[model samples]
Target: MPDTAYNLTVGDFNCTVFSDGCLIDPDETFGLNCILIEAEGRKILIDNGFGENSTGTAGLLLDNMKTVGRKPEDIDTIIFDHGHIDHVCGTFKKDGSPVFPNARYIITREEWDYIKSPPGDNETQNGFYRHARQYLLPLHDRFDVVASDCEILSGITLVPAHGHTPGNVMVDLSSQGERLLCIGDIIHSPREFADPACLAAFDVTPAGAIKTRAKILADAARDGTFVFATHFTFPGLGYIRQINGVFSWAPI
Candidate 1:
């Protein structure tokens, strides 16, 4: 039992990163550093952990949630940074009921479309496409399809960071002059920050993924914003900085 929940303050807002637990597939398959982030007191979850079949990697999310005094019922919003299985499967109970019953789920329209009819050539990695429908179909009534650049809350905006997935997006939070970007699987391992061109095998379009990584790193560096990577070890919160032409991640 590793403590997967962590809290940080950005001006008046409190952000907590909670784990749904971890997945330990080959580093080449799902990327070496995929984790989870939960923002504290906001009643929101960025990405849920993997499901039971993911081995011991599954179910720690509930534990981490409890550590932060957050129960499944307490979540007001469940934001899917992307529709990958490891990130979305934890949304359901063993009986198929939504784990976070009261929260409204938000996902990009592009992501929704991709999940609905993923290309056949990419079936293996995109298999989560089908699972997304299975797990989320029940919540269609509460699912809010958003655009690439939509604001989910007063201080939180969704920034389209396509390439890894057509609708892969990052959540940007601005509160009282402070900023943080919750980047979901953009740069899985911190080492990838040093070479943005290095992408995980799961990347739908390797080249495009690299480009998106570069763009995100540049923006975060320029704005001096904090970054919360969903899969960067436990408590995956850090700041991105650039030296010369290389990017560096400093965990906080």
Candidate 2:
């Protein structure tokens, strides 16, 4: 059975992380190890796991939500770190309707565009990109597309960390003097912290991704911020610290 949902209090607000489901893709597909986050109450699901593989495996999100006393309708915001399949595939039901009827969705404008006009001849090589456009395009009318850095709610700020995708972003939450940074796929593996220059083969622009990852790590380390990586191993929460001018991630 999956572990019970966990919560981290950020001042007066509570940020709970849940598992939507588990997937076992090729190591090359991930390039680095990762897990997804399913947060509840003031609910913000960071990403939706793959639904294409098997209904039981991909749709585990609803079950996990129920386990925590949350229903699909209870979700307020569905934040897409980027429109990758593992991250956004669960947004719709089997009937192809919005899963979170009442929640407003958000994604970087750049990412939205890239998937809309993906590079040709690269179609098969970019399965997730293709899936994102096909599935998410219909829901475009429901999105609150953001182009610049700004606050999404009282304790959450969207930090544009482009490169992985044109408008890939990270979420920052600050409350009661405590802060947490939800970095979406910035570093696929925690090990990347030991070598920030290491790039995932899937990165749209590997070099740009490296720079962005390093910058976010540096900032998080300096502030002693709690870090949430969408694709890190289970319980993807951690803290980044700088040692010898290099950043390292320590799970919290």
Candidate 3:
């Protein structure tokens, strides 16, 4: 098996980027990257990849974690960037039990509401929402929904960049002077880094996605901020570059 876990640090916090596996489609391939932040005494997991229910070459989060000496039960907090099935479905086991039983879940209030009352019925685009609810609703009372742009911890911040989903957010981590911005589903394909107009089909709000992508790509390039993308290549650690007025991705 290939190495799926990449360990690093964000200032004082120990961070690891785990590959939940990849989604290979006829036209494109997507890497599922999840982040684990060990801060103080907290074990924070950014997203749990597709669990048990996934079909093809995905759902490797649990095993990847195990290789790093971590387990589902060892997680103390699970912060969801959105309610997409691939990001939230791994919260439950095959028997419908919570995978991270000891962890408290956190998500933007806007996202939680969207999950409960999705855009349409099961037959429509709401199928993903319906599937997500099955794994999330059981832990309804365990979620601590907060407003967008909330600071999750001392160095971890949830920045609102809604577009792909009703309440999608980005994780911004700052420590000492170094910074890393985890743009969840913001630019699924590398080409989008240079062309913000290249929208993914799943983007619920294409206009918002384009606007947010443009802004983020510009800002990251200007500031030279390290970025972690959810669906980019494995480990997805890189810097956004801007020359003249064009943007591009520079993997490190």
Candidate 4:
């Protein structure tokens, strides 16, 4: 049983992390990490994971939420940093019903457009969206596409971070002087921290990804902001620190 959860407190806000417990050990693959943000009686979900159909080892969102005293319907708001299957598939079920039926879904307009109608025809370019098509397309109307940097609530804001995906964004959070960034796929592996210019194999725009990855890495290092990565490993929580002349991942 890969049911695991971690509690991170930022000031008075609570971010409960749940992992689907599926790790791929080939060339440094990634597992999924989902988060629930609770504050002022509002329950917001970051991303849902690949649902119950991912690699037979995933789909632990619902159960793990239960372990942490949260129910599916308790999710008042659902936000996505991107639309990759591993991150968005759990938003809707095979029957075309939202897992968090009562929660509002948020995505970047650019990401949704790419998922709905990818710009190019390269199989690799759109394959990830294709994998998530069946489940995500049906729930299109449920999405509240964001196009600018705006606060999702009192403390959470969406910051645009293009490159890895057309409209990938970072969930910026601040509460009581503490700052945290849920950087989606900006640096999938800790090794990338040592080489911020490193690009992932699935990078939608190689050049842009390098720049975006490096910028976020530098900012996080300077600000000493705690980051919640969707991949990396279970809990997927860490901070960026500078050592020598390069950066490194200091997992907290």
Candidate 5:
């Protein structure tokens, strides 16, 4: 199980990246990274993470929360990058009540629609619909809708980057003129930092994902925006740099 959490601060906001755990197989692999942010007098948790129902190696965000002296009840808001199972299952507990009962939830309306009323014959969409039916559907009352590029708070905002899933988005954090973007599942492999067009096999819309990834890389470089890729190596925070016409990730 992942027992450590990475703590860092951006200007005035503090953030902790908690490992829910990882999934590895000969054929496929990925990691689960949930973030807890303390900003502007509010406690916000990003991505509910895989909960108790996940493999034994996961479901430890709450435990990690305690290690950092935070309790589930202390969180006042929860924001999601998308409605994927690994990103949202932790919002509910074994008996189905919300894990952080006091926190208000936010998700893009496109994502809200994708999960609440998934339409299509695609198997992957069907699977996500099933997961949403069990996890997010019951939390409707506490959920709020936001635009693709809406400000979430005084110094935080959500930006659209749809591809990995419909309505997928990234978060923007700014304070004291410093900027960072929590790029949700934008580029899982570091190699993609150099080749922004490469698409993950599971991307629901490969072309859209490619376009978004390219733009994120270009914009981050142009804007000096630090980046936090959800599945990047530990710490995950970094910046994009261009060297000899190729982009590389420079971890901070």
Candidate 6:
């Protein structure tokens, strides 16, 4: 298994990228990059990768955390980028217990409602629905559901980027005027930067996904905001640049 953990500073916040290794599908390999942000004496986990329930080289986020001197219990807040299995499964243990027992959770109200709704027709998506229910439903009372773009903390904001999922969001972090957008599954490949219309098969609403991607890429390019992509290669940190209005990924 690939054990990867990288640490960097985001203005006043200490940010760490921990990998749950890679999720290998038939067509592509996705890096399960989860972020840990330490701000205001809070250990906030952006997403929980696949945990004990998944089979494969993935599910290493918890193990990787040890390298940075962090334990599951150390997490005070867990913000789910979405309800996807890869993003929420690590919240629970094989015995149906929460991995981060002491942490409170946050997710968009739309996403929470969708997760509890009836399963969809797509078999693959239904499977994801089941996993989401198993891992997240049990913690219903612990969740703080937000209805719109709002700041959950002093420097972190959950901006509605809904597309990939009903209430999927991108985390906007600002400290001392430096900004980083944790665009969860917004653009899987760097190639998408130049062609924002490109769609990911997992997107529930392809058109919305495309629109959100285009807007984010353009805005990031214009504002010179750094980005942390969830499915990009390990330690997915980069800046978006535009040439002739075509955005491109410039990895740092």
lDDT of 6: 0.86
lDDT of 2 by residue, 36-149 (tens): 223334666666665443445444666666776777787777778788777777787655677778877888778877877856565442875766777788888888887648
Off by over 4 Å in 6: 1-3, 194-199
- List RMSD in Å for every model shown: 3.0, 3.5, 1.8, 2.1, 2.3, 2.0
lDDT (0 to 1) per candidate: 0.73, 0.69, 0.85, 0.80, 0.80, 0.86
Collision pairs in model 1: 16-38, 16-39, 16-40, 17-38, 18-38, 20-61, 33-231, 34-231, 35-231
Q: Order of all candidates by lDDT, from best down to worst? A: 6, 3, 4, 5, 1, 2
- What's the TM-score of each model vs. the native? 0.88, 0.85, 0.94, 0.92, 0.91, 0.94
What lDDT does candidate 2 reach at residue 118? 54
Model 1: per-residue lDDT, tens digit, 1-252? 335666677666666666666556555323212222334456666767665435665567777667657677877788888888878877887667777778888899998887777346766665756668676776788889999899877788899999988899998887788887888878887668766555456687778888888888898888888888777766677788888977887877
Per-residue lDDT for 34-108 in model 4, tens only?
888888899888888888657777887888888767888888888888877778778767665777879888888
Per-residue accuracy of model 3 over 1-252 as CA lDDT, tens digit each: 347999988888889999999988787888899999998889999989888878868889999999978998899999999988888878987888888879999999888888787456435447667667776877888899998899989989999999878799999988888788999888888777565666456677778889888888888888888999999898999988889887777888
lDDT: worst 10-residue window of model 1: 28-37
Any idea what lDDT model 4 has?
A: 0.80
lDDT of 4 at 116: 77
Cα shift from native, residue 59, model 4 (Å) = 1.4
Cα lDDT of model 6 by residue, 24-114, tens digit = 8776787889999999999999999989877887899988999778999999999998998888989888888888989999999899999
Worst lDDT window (10 residues) for model 6?
Answer: 191-200
Off-target runs (Cα >4 Å) in candidate 3 are: 118-124, 194-197
**Candidate number that wins on lDDT, 1 or 2:** 1
Which residue pairs show collisions in model 6? Answer: none
Q: Candidate 5 on 32-150: residue-level lDDT in tens?
A: 77888898789988897778767676677888778878899999999898887777888887778778979999999998887777457777656655666676777788989889898
Q: Is candidate 2 or candidate 4 better by lDDT?
A: 4
